[model samples]
Target: MMKMNDVAKLANVSPATVSRVICHPELVSEETRSKVLEVINQVNYKPHIVARQFRTQKTRNILVVVPDITSAFFSKVLRGIEHVALKNGYQVILGDTENNIEREKDYVDLLLQKQVDGMILLTARQDKVRLEELSTQFPLVLACEYIDGLNVPTVSIDNVSSARKATEHLISLGHTKIAHISGSINVILSRDRLRGFKQAMMSQNLEVESSYIQEGDFKFESGYHQMMKLLALEVPPTAVFAFNDEMALGAIKAAKDSGVNVPNDLAVVGFDNIKMSSINEPSITTIDQPKYEIGKKAMEILLKLINNQELHNKKIVFKDELIVRGSTRKEIDVKETLEMV
Candidate 1:
């Protein structure tokens, strides 16, 4: 293993300067920084992360807790976090809560016992009172999901505004009887999205009928079942908006199985523009939350907090995009004319 002393001798700079180059490169002159980097690369210098952690009282390890690791939505976020963490010479430890409050609490306790430098949380539950107590001892960041009034730093999209935009898009498409399928209402994301949906409908002078709204667990099966129930309503909705892409896909599947022609008999829109949404038949029109960027930004914030650096900005909000596709189309004439031309 190449030591900092060897790099210092090779670059003719102090070991402290070498450390500064590795950790705080901006403080050193560009010429000196480049010289130290060149020597580091030549010698394949690998810093002793454990020793550094012990000396600095930082583990240089961050725990990222997700509700479900299998979801494609979260996988993209994980990739983003990994990119930033690896670049910063920090290690990320994953904790999959499976949406279980007890399991989430257990993971938090374990990570704290291990003395991790910080934590990035996606599975924030209302029962995180214990975790809140732990934050007094260590830094914590909330990603994707937030706990209202928690005073924790968070990185997320503006769910309320984006959901309103999505609903307004449907309204612009001449959909008056728009329905909504949502995740658990207890979660902040779900509550905000639901509020947005209602606000959009109310703004347009459209009644938000409780009978048209369905609740799901943000799962494919939950979506499928909920859509089936909605389809059985006395006055079935002509359009439906799902809180996430998986639910939207599930609704599509249910509509097809029920012999309903999509965008003709039904128009479906989803959130979180996951990859499958674009590839699915009649491709879903959905809100594109920058999942990967959210993950990366969250990790970046966590790393800064872990290093005890001043975070110039505490809350980071990513923008959302609306992707139009065939699933929500009400007319083929415009598309046909464009294609012919």
Candidate 2:
């Protein structure tokens, strides 16, 4: 509640002296700095975020745009972003765009209008050209998902490689008729995942049936419905790979309803080792994407940009791990943490 002037009055110093002590302690005499600190501690003085923003031209706030705030996968990332921002004296403002382009644009306005100092996008809804333009104007970074040819800072795992790893796990179980439940092809990650599944399938000289690849919206209901469709086929697939954990869980439920035993009759693999994937009836065998680390790295990049510092690298890719659980093969569930710095 105490103002800088009040602190200066108590310390027998000018306001500028107090400012110098706080902003650049190295430039201020140790005696002056000690006096100001003693007064500040006595009064429990705190800097006004708004006033500091006015002086520095920074909001001290970050905007994080997420496609679905309810997603547990993104929740981990959000926590990672908040952990760094709050530690740096900045608060995070979360915006849920619901995967709607128009809604996303509305939140992007906050960054364009300078309501937030910088922005971190956790979803992939922005156009490539628009992202390029925004990067030239604002401090922006992409997390979890990224756009190709944008040259903007990005932090994510290799979707294609992760997907291939997941599929290869299923293939190692000696399942030849492996099916894929894909997320929306509109998103590059989804396409990359599908491509990986195909790549793994071809490596084994297995045929990819067009009917086995069902399009999903990265939702549980969509996964369940798609699994049902795959099951109804005259010759159903022996195994399935889902792009996300939610979809993978859905597929498991659908298979159970169809009187199929998981890992025994139909092996299922999922991406994004969300919390639920481990506790589910059949623990999911998934690719750990290091969601939390990715979030933290994205915010770190945004901070560098907001400070007008040069980036050592434009793209940051994290490695993913394949976790073996009950969903794919019946054994002692072995969990692997996706550790990336």
Candidate 3:
């Protein structure tokens, strides 16, 4: 109900002085600031955010493009992004691409339309040239997944290294016949993880069997079905490493359904230490990617770009930890599980 002019009129000060007190408090004297604050509180005056945005050519909002919003993995990262955005006096616009390139393009159009100030893509499948062109003109930050050879600022862990370590953990537990449940090979993240799994196997003089590897789509159903296929093998793998938590959880279910106990008959390890991984029946062993910190760092990078601040660095990679859980433990004897099966 109360505009800046109304407050200015009541306070007997010019609108510009009121603006100074509200927008640039340091420009106004302490006495003036105190008086304007008193009147603002008394009249319950609220500045028009839309008008401010229009004048400044800034929406004070950022877009976050997620490949799949339903996954808890992204949700935690989003929380971190939101935290940083709010602290910096900005709002977040979430765009769930549903793993569809077309949907991601639609969201990108919002940035081009000036509907938002900037964007952070969690996973991208857009044309390389187009993305490169857009990055040159806009404030875009890629998180978790990145395009190789592109200088786009990114925040993520070393997927390949983490995956290798996960497989090495299984090997350390005396699992000779290790299987891999891979995410789609199209994405760099998946490919890097697969490469890491292979590297670990080679380092230990273990044979990376083609029959033991199953392709998944980074989803529970795919993981479940793949694990089922592995179970039917004449000589099933003694351990399995899944690209993500959902797939790993599915593998656990599939193993149980086939009368096999996890970490006993079949050790299971996964990437992304999602919350469910810790609470699952036989809790999953996984690589703990700093989900929240990744989001926070991505947002911080985007803000720096938005404000035209000099970036201290372009590429930021976080470290990951391999957490040992029930799923990969040796407490349950393999012989006992085999006899039960």
Candidate 4:
């Protein structure tokens, strides 16, 4: 029940001096600061955070827009975002859009209404005009997904090049009959990855079969179903490159159910090396995206924007690694890894 005035009286300082000591200590003399701190400890006073935020016109809350919260790959990224946000004295508000445009707009409204300080968008919405307009209006950063025309700061890997490297790995292993399972065609990353797969195939003088390319929705179920269709082909593919780990695992399961031996009869490669990929029956060979690093870097850039600082780069690309595992070649024993766990 102690107020700022009460602390001021105990410290024998004016109310304004007490306010300066509490909110902006650098503005007050060190002697005055010491007296205020001593009195504050005796009173055990806590600043009213909400009232302070209102006075400064800042919520100190960041809105992170996610396409799907259940995604294992995204979970790591979210952990990174939360870590940076907390360390920087800011709070994160997750906006799980579930790939819904209406829900995305709702989060945008929150930012426009001054409910949050800034935003980091993980969902890649195709509304270029809207995004571009918003970029000029407020502090915005895109992580894991991006649009070309927008001048907003973005943190992402080169999807096309990463996909190309994965496909090339399969080709180096002498796989001529290679198939591709891509995320939805609407997504820019999906399209870039598919383009990379095609580039790798053409480099080896192999035919890019129409029947071998399957479009999926970046879900486990879709991966399973699309893979089944690929398996049903008259001339089944010897290797498959899936867009994500979730879909890649699904493809592997389908191959097993159909009595196909993985890496022996059918080799599989996937993007986004999520945690589950390492412990699965056949540890998946995947493109290792720096998921946590991406989130950390994105939040860092958002903070720069929030502080009205100039950014060095608007489009930031991180490196990607191709990890070889049992799905492509024997790496670890599933039973042994499980036992270690």
List candidate 1 stretches off by more than 4 Å: 1-50, 128-132, 333-341
> What is candidate 1's TM-score against the reference?
0.85
For model 3, the superposed segments whose C-alpha errors exceed 4 Å read 5-46, 332-341
Task: Point out where model 4 deviates above 4 Å.
Answer: 2-50, 330-341
The parts of candidate 2 lying over 4 Å away from their true place are 5-50, 331-341
Candidate 4 residue pairs that clash: none
Candidate 2 per-residue lDDT over residues 217-290, each given as its tens digit: 99999999999999999999999999999999999999999999997889999989999999998899999988
Question: What's the TM-score of every candidate structure?
Answer: 0.85, 0.87, 0.88, 0.86
The residue-level lDDT of candidate 1 at 270 comes to 96
Please tell me which predicted candidate would have the highest lDDT against the true structure: 3
State residue 322's C-alpha deviation in candidate 1, in Å: 1.5
Q: List, residue by residue over 122-215, the lDDT tens digit for candidate 3.
A: 9967888888899898999999999887778889899989999999999988889999999988888989999999999999999999999899
Residue 133 alpha-carbon offset, candidate 3, angstroms: 0.9
- Model 3 residue 271 lDDT score: 87
Ten-residue region with minimum lDDT total, candidate 2:
332-341
Per-residue lDDT over 60-124 for candidate 1, one digit per residue giving the tens place of the 0 to 100 score:
67788899887879989999999998666567899999888778887787566866778888978
